[model samples]
Structures are given as C-alpha cells and as structure tokens.
Target: MRKLITDRRLLFGYILAHLFIFFTFEQEKVFWYIFTATMLILISYSILDETEQRESRKFHLFIGILSGALLYGVFWIGDILIDLLKLPLSNQITALFKLFSPELTWHYLVLFLIIVPGEEIFWRGFIQKKLLTHTNPWTSIVLSTLLYASVQIHSGEFVLILAGLTGGFVWGILYAWKRSIRLVIISHLVFDLLLFWLFPLR
Candidate 1:
C-alpha cells in the first residue's frame, strides 16, 4: 500500500499512460498521430525501466502465437454473444473503430510493428512487472488490468474499456507465468494482427 503511493516510477509511468491515452482518444485532431507518438514514448520508458530475460526463443514464439489465436477466438465468441443479446454496443464499437481503426497501409504496419509491441512492453512488461514485486500474482494482474482499463475511460466507450480489461488480464497472466517480455510481445503482436487486420471486430 505504501509502495503504491511512494513508488515514483510506477506513478509516473501510469500517469504518463493516462495522459497519452487520453490524448489519443479525446483529441479530435488526428488519432493516429497522437496514438503513435504515445506508443513510442511509453515503449521507450518501458525499455529503460524493465529488465527482461531472454530464454527459449522458440518456446516463447510457439506459446505466444497460440495464446494470441485463442484470445482472438475468445473475443470472437464474446462478440457473437453480445450480438445475440442485442446489446446496445453497436454504436460504441463502431465509434471505437472510427476513432482508432487503421485505414491506411502504414496504420497496420505501425500497429503490428510498433504500437502493439509498445503496449505489451509497457503495460505488461513494465507496469505489471512492477506490480508483481509489491503483490501476489493474482493481485498484481488485477491491479494492472484495472490501471490498463482506466486509460481507456477517456474514450467513453464501455466496450473499449472492457476490451482493455480483458486483454490486459490475459497478458498480465502471461507475463507473470513466463516472465518473458518477448513472449507477451509476440502474443500481443499476433492478437492485434488478427483483431485489426485479418478479422477486425468492428
């Protein structure tokens, strides 16, 4: 509890995440520009703050890809369930895509190569990793998930916030289990690949 208030790096990183993410979602100027900038900055900070171990390259790739595919499947089912229930989330989902979806070729490129990696490295590799040092795995994962979801609140889209919570929980567990930044990064990369380009939810 004391660490949560006194840890400067944790507080600074989360506060920065909120500012950047809020700018990405709320600014009407241009989404990609702000979003890309945010990722770059956060990723830089993560790399400097987190020290990750490199081990079992092939195993990480295998599990990461597999988990990503499974995660996407979970979302697909969730999407179907939401549809079946006739939830009033169509507009919110559509708005989420409109505001942040990749249209141009480079948008996909950046999302895969930079933005996804940036998010995984920062949120899971750095933030969650920090939380683990101060709490149990379950508690750390939940805390990280909440902080991760909180950044999406400025979007004012419940679905988007929910997505953040769900995805963050998965990645948080992966990081805690494997303690490999590469593994989670690969998982995130694969998940975004399917979600954004191959089979977008919206």
Candidate 2:
C-alpha cells in the first residue's frame, strides 16, 4: 500500500542500501567506504531536517544521554546472558569475526560514526515516527524493534541481533517519550563508541 510504503520509506531505503552493498562490493574495505559515505549523507540530512522542524535541542541531548545509557545497559545484559547460555550458534557467529586487525579497527570507527548514526535516524527517527502516526506508542515501539531486528538477520549473529532489538526498542521508547531525533542520535553514538572500543572484534 502507498500509505505503508510512505510510512516505512526510511526502513526500506536502509534495507536497499545494505542489499546494494552486499551484492555490488566484494571487498570489505570498499564496501565499508561506500556504506560509510552513504550514512554520513543520511545523518546530515536528518540533522538539517531536525533543525528546520525547530525541535528542542537541549531536550534531545538530555534524553540522548539517558537513552544511550539505558540501551547500553540492555546490550550489556543481553551479552552476558548469551555468554552464560553458551549458545553454539551465537558463539560460532562471534568466531567468524575473531580476526579483526588494525585496519578493521579503523573501519569500525568509521562505521561507529557513520553507519550507526544513519541507522538510528532511519530506524528510530524515521520508522518509529512513521509507526507512531498510525499506532499507539507501545505498538510502534515493538514494530520498530522487530524491523530493527530483521535488519540484523543478515549479520548471522544471534547475540548481536538480540542486542539490536533491545537497543532499538529503547531508542523507540525514548523518541516517543521525548519526541527528539537528536537524543536518539546522541545515545546511539555513545553506545556504539563504547561497544567498539571496549570489545574490538579479535
């Protein structure tokens, strides 16, 4: 339906972008370069749109920090549970990325800044906002979380997928509670920075 597509345009766009990256690029470095560039462009657009909407900057920043902490806590807990369970599939998924070198570390930094912010805007700011237009806050949160989790299925990492869903839900709630994209972006950036720095793959 036109209405559904209109509401979920950002989500659709993000998925399309990933598909292109997956098929068109064979080299990881090249794929990441294109992906990061795309993310930077999307994030810039989201920021400008927020400014034009005359949203409260201070409120978004405040909520961003709080939501970031909450999401980080959720991710931390999920990671611990995964470890305790010692799920074979999850551990194997993690093992695939165990050879992270310095180059990959630098690439991750770029991903943290660009890809994560872009995804936050698409999933939290755009998709969640659209869902709220037709659904209740809780419904929108859950739908957005599910969609977010779906995106991670390609990662082949169950633990990471679970964390993404939890983080997405928290961001959705925060956005609904405060109605600010800035906060979501701030929180997302902080959470990602910590994750990348503290737990560098390899």
Candidate 3:
C-alpha cells in the first residue's frame, strides 16, 4: 500500500479524481462522499511519502503569513471589482458559501484541517517534487500549477478559474522556493479563512 501510494502515477490519477468529483458531482452529500474519500487517499499517501519532510522554519512561517495577507488583499480588490463590474457569477460564489457554511464546522474542519493540508501535500510535496526529479524546477512548478488550476475548470466561472490559476502559481512558486509544505499549507489555510469566512467576496 505504501509503495503503491507513493508512486507519482497514482498521485496524478488522484488529482484527476479530484477534478472529476468536483466538476461532475452536484448533490451535496455525494460531493462530500467523493471529497472525503479523495482527501483521505491523498492524506494517506502524504503520510506514506516519507522522502519529503514538512519544514517549520520560523522564517517560512513569517513569509507564509505575509503571503496570506497579500493574497487576501488581492481577493479584496478582486471582489470589489467583481461587484463594480456586476459579473454574473453568483452560482460560483454560492457554491463556495455553501461549502463553507456554518464556518465553525465546515470552514475550519474541511478547509483548515483537510483540504488545504491535503492539497499542499499532494500538489506540492508529491506532484511537483516528483516532477522536479526529471525536469527544471520552474517547469515542474508551472506544470503542477496548471494542473492545479485545471481541476477548477469545472466551476464554469471565469473568475474562479482565474483565481485558481493565480493562487496555484503563487503557492507553487513559494513551495518550489521555500521547500516547505507546511508553510504553503498554512498560507493556503489563512487565505481560505479570510476569503471564505472573514472577508467573503459577497
């Protein structure tokens, strides 16, 4: 099981699975079923991929927090622009709010504990790390970033897709530079907290 999960091919397959479930599933309960299943698979693989270590350097932490703040600023500006422009993307926004409903439970548990950590582990720690072995670091980061954004294509919202692409690149570049999965994960968690709960675009 460990060997199987550690393979990059398996990780890529799981990435596709995330996209499939995210785009195709509509029923909330069904979505959660696949979401929880995929998250567990990725989390298990992350634990078993022992070649990488999740660093917790203080400098990385500081940078991570700063990165989160910067991302929040971008979101704030973008939200204002969206409102001013009257973009008809409410369905995309509604999906996000529903996913993070009753913040104490959904946002904290799902976003903070599971999704963010799992994503960083799989996308950065595993996928990009594997790609780096055979390609230029920047190339690997960019490819992984594109794949990261690809999953959100099913959102059927241009703004959401743009946000995913931009955020993936930022986080991907940070992970490539810092080599800190924990840092990227924390940065992502902070950004999600601010975007979804504290300063929601709505």
lDDT of 1: 0.85
* Tens digits of per-residue lDDT for model 2, 1-202: 3465564455555576566444423444465666676666655644443322233455566667666766667656665666789857556546535522224766877766667778878777666776776677898889888887775665556755776777888888877777777788788877766665655333
Instruction: Work out the TM-score per prediction.
Output: 0.92, 0.73, 0.79
Q: Which stretches of candidate 1 lie over 4 Å from their true place?
A: 50-59
- Candidate 1 vs 3: which has more TM-score: 1
lDDT of 3 by residue, 1-202 (tens): 3444476674665566565557444545455545656666777765665554345364577888889879889878877776688877655666766763444465357767787788888878777776666567688778778877777666555766778788888898888788888789878988887877787776
Worst 10 residues of 1 by lDDT: 50-59
Model 1: per-residue Cα lDDT over 25-132, one tens digit each: 776568887888999999989877743443334458898999999999999998888888988886778777777788899888888888988998888878888887
lDDT (C-alpha) at residue 65 in model 2: 69
lDDT of 1 at 152: 84
RMSD of each: 2.0, 4.0, 4.5
What lDDT would each prediction earn against the true structure?
Answer: 0.85, 0.65, 0.71
After superposing all C-alphas onto the true structure, candidate 2 shows an RMSD in angstroms of 4.0
